[model samples]
Target: MRVYVAKSGDSLLKISETHKIDLNKLLIVNPHISSPMMNITGSKVYFPSSPISDTLQTPISECPLPSPSDLLSSWIPLTSLEQMADTDYDVLIVGSGAGGGSVLRRLAEQWLNSGKKVGMIEAGSLLLPTHVRNIPTVNDTRFSQYFHTVSKWTGKYLPDFPGARQLFALGGRTLFWGMSAPRMDDSEFFDWPMPLKEMKYYYNIAEKIMRVSTAYMEGSSIQEILLKRLHENGFPEARDVPTPADLEVTKYGQIHSDVFWSSISALAYALNRMPFDLAVNARAVEVIVEQNEVVGIRVMSPNKRAYVLKAKTIVLSGSTFETPRLLLHSGIKGRAIGHYLTNHSLLLATAKVSRQQFPEVLGTLSIFIPQTKKHLYQIQMGGPGGEDQWYLWYSQYEEKALLDELLIGISAFGKVESRFENYITLDPNKQDKYGVPKINVNFSYSKQDTEIIHQMAAALNQVSSAMQAPLIVPNNRQAICLMPPGGDYHEVGTCRMGDDPHTSVTNRYGQVHGVAGLYVADNSVFPSMGAANPTLTTVALSIRTADYIVNQLK
Candidate 1:
């Protein structure tokens, strides 16, 4: 036997191939090795005394081997066109975003050992590390790097209105989300089909999977001072913002909080131990329904070739916009197919905290102040850009002086009442690259929405005064600035969930009304937009839906 020191990126398979030994012999000699595919960098590997060609020259009948599919099960294999063709799946999940990803995870966990084929098809490409690593600045010119403007709605709304932004990747928007994991208030679910008690169980499961913690940035001096001030000033709702971040303090007291940005890709990656397939860059053009039951989906590939994927179950977890467009294209007629659209009204403000007030302040701190009225508005005490990098990106050049001693942000997010007028419809003339009709959003703020914004702004000002911080105005603005509609990117309520089939698109369990085996699990199923971020709720509800589907399959 010869000793071999594995170099970086050296796997057992590579080592065995390089050493010209049979994989079984290599494993027999290296009993301490845990996995054959694991990168055993800097580890010692033993080589058997066998000629390199001996194993290669062996008869295939004598040398039993695992199949190629068995060897590739360590990772979720990205399916190619040839592999996806002429195949059937037990469950076909469309849109590998947050909701879709969560449902896939739950289903994969439940049916991992059951040999059930759960296939996930995404309209976008695989989310690469490079795509999210180099996030563009919030400047107007560079904004298109991460966001695309809806061409049809460009000239319809006000000039100041910022159009909706959608990310076309395996993880979808979760790749670039702010990682806020706040839960909805019970009152927010008053119109939901499921009760609050059932949702709480799923919320607990999601919180664990996402690693959500309210103690994020707990030991920071700035957080301590801010929490004390808020509590003393009678703002009980001003507590630590729940986030999927792990806080680590160095011996030198330097704070480093690592955010846990859970995406669909992460969920798929975690299911490596399970058996599943994920097909990327496959956009669903239509659902093949027979006798009001979905049997297959007509998908178009990047090269414009269309094919049918047969499945026992179908789920549409596409975002609020794309899901509706897919349903309309599939001839799923309903009054609420693309209506009752709602998103949060965002108001951005900034404040400067003098160094003299609290000298021990360091790093960023976030706190949420909930309003007394249910489903009204919540005042967030941190900037959208969580870290110092984002702080420098959005802050004005003139405010550079206050960078060392600035609190820098206040945002008021008010719930928009769901109205029938705020709806989406397929455009008659416009079509995207896939020859599908483009979506037309006919939405405007209601009178109650305007009043809520004014109230939220005043409340933010009150907090600024109590904290003894002054406004940091950019462009010499004297008051709070309202960001254009869809700025928050928390759009929901397009395919709302309710008990009535005529009024809503999906039922309590996310099953499409009158369409067996067709489900909707994304934010499009929201009945109303709660003040909290919708990602957590979307995930929790998806978990619930997955359980329902599993029970039905049984």
Candidate 2:
């Protein structure tokens, strides 16, 4: 395939005609390149068809030509017919969230050193803080969008789906996470078909590369109170034992701190450190599989333009919904492609507390409550920016002077036992622009989950009574915190990892057992939802996968 750049007079239509390719076809490859209404100048465009033989020899000196292998080939879209085909890569890592981002960085470093090409593809458009803050409506919560989507409550009981649940931006959801990095309980791994010892080492390696820190929690009032209460109430504190220099801080501190200070942004800044190519705003529509082995990925961009990224190794890090949707569209159905989906359950119970100011809480410093005894064991912490409004009240919305106190938002997360009832399916008639089926995420709570919520709420109420703070449940008027499937970016367990490929999509190493050079390194591969945030574990698995790949290459 050949590349082209635009001149002052080159409109997409004119380019297609001059290159002898269909104009309509050209529009497909460059859907979003156009602005909200018209085309934006100096924006990179991708044409769908290949260049004609006559047009290939016509070189314009105004536009610089680059080698096909060069990462920045050209800004022009494909314009020639018959040459619009898929490109191949040594490794094609999908998604760009925690799992995909880490693996891409690691592989890019290794591949650059080895003089091999590695390709990283992200479905969402690249996220920029400057662009977000510039937008008028979203400026106030620009930070939230920078990180992850907000949670919503449905009715008074069920979970509500938020308009902004998942952020489809360049860094994936890492931009919004509170950076709570806790390792999965040994029991969580024991339940899986793989050995826990191997996973532990991987987790350690990932934590190190991420530079997880606990310094953010040093003087946090919320962490202190929660830790003291847990200890005083006979609950166990997060393990804070010392480790070697190689393993610096406590796992809890390493995982849960602010992800704004994460390695992801650094990798983005060091894009030149990569050997192959990183394509943002490119959405993978389907995986090219032949004879049960993965071959390549077909993607569609905002311009409705289609292309392929063929690879010897294919990694699906498109999170839960996207990964499964891609596989299903690719006709690689499995027993667990979209089953066992789980996310942390949250409830926003506000109250009028005696204290006007809420405690200065560190993100993710939760009180761990064990469920063995069944007195409502949970990990509770402040909600997104809830600490800021702790002492403020709504003078306009509520009874003015009756209760002008601060509101605290606490999230109670517990174990979500797997259930087949909660799963993902393709919407029958709803097709995306690519003509692929849109995902229908069926997020329902099992009796066990509902019971757990009840138990957690009861325990929280007990704490409130002790503090003499009257609980103020949000009116069933609208959803607040408790939201349905895909609410939080913590979705996992679709392409599960286990010992048996017959039952699991990928093996413990994240390799698709039946297919060589195919791996699933994102949250979708988790076999079980541990009672902790999944980012740390996902990062660990990505690091582990990178090491395995590096060793294999050696």
Candidate 3:
């Protein structure tokens, strides 16, 4: 028998997997180990001396082979750009955010064992395997610090949109999103090229996979009282926010470690159904087009080497900023490639409610006021404290000094009209290390938009007054602060969808206008996202686009 010494963090199951031996066989050989799942660190474990297989006779090999696990990543397979250039892919998705992830997941489910080659390339490296909230060690404060370290404050360069920040990672911005998954108002979708009925069908599927739930405020007394107060007051439509959070209990072998769903969740689902090649730090410099037909992509490695990846179908999900930059930089012809930029105009305020307002059992308050025909903005109210608020990475409960105040964060998002003046253009003067042109944002509010912002601010005042929680202005802050244009991180419509090629970048199916086999499936495709958060709609449209690509392949 082979005597193998265990190192730190080595478990019996991991050892059995590393040595290609069954758990029972390892247990039989060494009775000292209590369980197969127990960690055996700095200890000797007897392994099966000879290799065995399911065949009648003992399995023998003439040539020695390395471990089956991927050296770069054990959870999912990773291939280099050099290797990817050798094979043609049926579908190659750019970006790994909500849109790109949903597309990959749906395609993997629909094309399982179909012998189709699907690949994905991300310009950023693997930042986190799951949503930051799923990590146990990351509390709200820690998360804030870590996020600042990993994300790029791109807004610093855009004078008009100073609040914009970019996160280039596997899961994208969903890693730190508020998780409030609200669909756009039915009227808001009126201008979109896609049908409303079809949108509803896909929305249902997206909700199921993302685990949208109102169970968060189930037993919270604070929410109960606050909700009742808002309903009785002018705002009767106030209710618990639908968050894409998996709160189900883990049973059997299924571990529900993913409390908050993100694009990494989608990636995991896709990998389970089918195998796909993934390459991080691989940037798509240009989309190769020939006579108005898509051919492949010119991708660059981190080391400045370029590789030509042949893919008949390419979906650009690099987001509102990056997608349009790629299209314009690649010289793809389209009038609306980088126009009609839109985002929710946000306002922030906080208030302190008396602790005597609710019962002794005080829980967090999280509610949303949806957009209505009369009101063009939506409101999100949450929290019982500044640091000890709900929906953090990992909540903590501890005894502290008694207080008579309840801290609540109030925010409103007003619908910004999609306009040609508000656009993103390639800044040829500035370039990254890869020679990719940086983006220059040109944005401002119109008279109508300013009116809406004023309305939103008034609504906040009214809501706060109605709740008996007067809005409080902190030191060096105004009574109601209007967040910067890009602060909401909801930018969209740069490459909007429409029937007219002269006015839009992608068509109804997310395919790039006048370019065969090229598609755009991120927030950039939204004609008008309204006051709703763009995550859910982005995913739904992506799923539809993936289906379109699948049907086209057949």
Candidate 4:
């Protein structure tokens, strides 16, 4: 067998044409080659000893291709706690959510060619196929099974507020995110530490990598009606939703269908194909700091074994709650470490869409409604409210009769002003099973938040009236239903970024204010939580931070 090193832009077709071997033969020999157009750069390809007949025919039943699991299993081997502790790494990332996953991919791609080692520690176990393949509802038991054990809040300030849901799997909460990736408007970035231009550049990079689709409201009839209504009301900023999915294109060049949105699990699977190390079920206990600098991290394995892994740089991408808990447990002190905790106030209002008027609109379509003088909100048409047959039966309506009654829901995410009172602190007397400090969360909405919710309710009522669709009132509410704080799961502003070290925990580049070689790349570092969802912005910020770290290392 002859070995051929695949270069950049090398494809199986090109290799077959160059070597004068049949495509089927090439695929048969290299079972790992899933697709002909797949880029196998920096890898070795094996050729047969002699070229077979040009007309060689292989039986379809005889040829077996590798499954996604097979391919993923062969990508990278999971490192054991002992193995990880034995070697020092150039960069160590904690958490594998969108922020940490993006940073790891960016840095690993740049450092892979240089032979620099990059390590990632995930507190949760590896995500199983059952977790990724199923789309369970929020109330489903499977949903709870994927989260961390300590996913609830305990504190005096806990109001009727919704409890925090923490997912500690390979991709964190991103494995079950709504996949709404909207760019923050200019007004929303007023409180951001960096300039909008710099942030926009990183947003472009993140959108490109995540495959955020641009064709938003092309085929949805509900979106068309909403756009017309917004235009008639002089709100032109209400545009099609930007999601991380590829739209299905037709033969006539019209894009109409919606695909599954991108997730961090897919990104992690791709990154695992590269040269990197990932340790799962390894909970980070503390940062091994020496002389005011981070040198390593202490982690406990699943079997109660502890290990200390050395690294030149440590990045904390744990969620807002866990990140602050880790820092506080490590004896890192800052007034802003766990202060300014904020999440958007979620208000959901639903109305039945006239299916007779638009029978073609079947799936959901998201639209952003930016308020010039108030909080920005999002409107989604054809949600999951009126889809289930069991729900129709329980509501005393036949499923066949409700075929023309699609549910259109609007979500208004009010901008909750970050306050010092809404914060998370480590419980002095409590500890989790892993011997880590338990977190006590204290968060509540302000008066302004209430005002924004009222405004959003009023706007939703106007839209429902304009559409001539009656509101779906389940709880006998006069207006919209206001969900508790943290309902959106868009918590941020804990470890805020600012120019002043005393007021913020991290700088503009996400590096720690007083601690060297320590950085934060998750929503915990957000200075402000705009009405927009935090996933896209968190990813963009993480990419920028990764670029900065690469430059600093160089």
Which predicted model would earn the best TM-score? Answer: 3
Q: Write the per-residue lDDT of candidate 3 for residues 1-554, one digit (tens) a residue.
A: 67889989888899988877788778877899988888889999987554432332456779967775624454557888988999899999999999999999999989999999999999998888898878867766678889889999999999989999889988899888888999999998788887899999999999998999898778899898888889889889999999888887889889998889899999999999998999999999999999888989999988899999999899999989999999998999898989999999999988778988788887667899999999999999987775353331244453333457877889999998899899989887999998999999999999989999999999999999878888887767997999988999999999899999989988899999889999998999998878988899899999999999999999
Q: List the residue pairs that clash in candidate 4.
A: none
**Residue runs of model 3 more than 4 Å from their true location after superposition:** 1-75, 387-393, 396-402
TM-score of each model, paired residue for residue: 0.79, 0.69, 0.87, 0.78
Q: Which scores higher on lDDT, 2 or 4?
A: 4
lDDT of 1 at 366: 79
Q: Candidate 2: which stretches are off by over 4 Å?
A: 1-88, 129-164, 221-226, 234-263, 269-272, 351-377, 383-407, 465-470, 473-482
In the range 1-554, model 2's lDDT, one tens digit per residue, is 44556666567766766777766555656676463234344656565534443455477787777866565333311111113234456677777777887887777666666666567767665454322322334422344543444322221232332322555766666654655676777767767866788888877776666665555354555446545654555445532211111223348555322223343543553365764466777778888888877778787777888886678788888777778888778777677778877776665455444333344333323333433434323444442223333211111232222223444454556567676556777877888677888766666777887887677676666555443445665655322255444444577888888887656788778887677787888888888886667888888888778878777657
For model 4, residues 24-54, the per-residue Cα lDDT tens digits are 8788778888998888997788776554533
Q: Which pairs in model 1 have colliding backbones?
A: none
Least accurate 10 contiguous residues by lDDT in model 1: 392-401
Full-model lDDT, candidate 3: 0.88
Could you tell me how far off, in angstroms, the CA of residue 454 lies in candidate 4 after the best superposition?
Answer: 1.7
Using lDDT as the measure, what is the rank order of every candidate, best first? 3, 1, 4, 2
What are the runs in model 4 whose C-alpha is more than 4 Å off?
1-76, 128-161, 248-273, 359-363, 371-402, 475-479
**Each candidate's lDDT (Cα)?**
0.76, 0.60, 0.88, 0.74
Residue 465 lDDT (model 1): 74
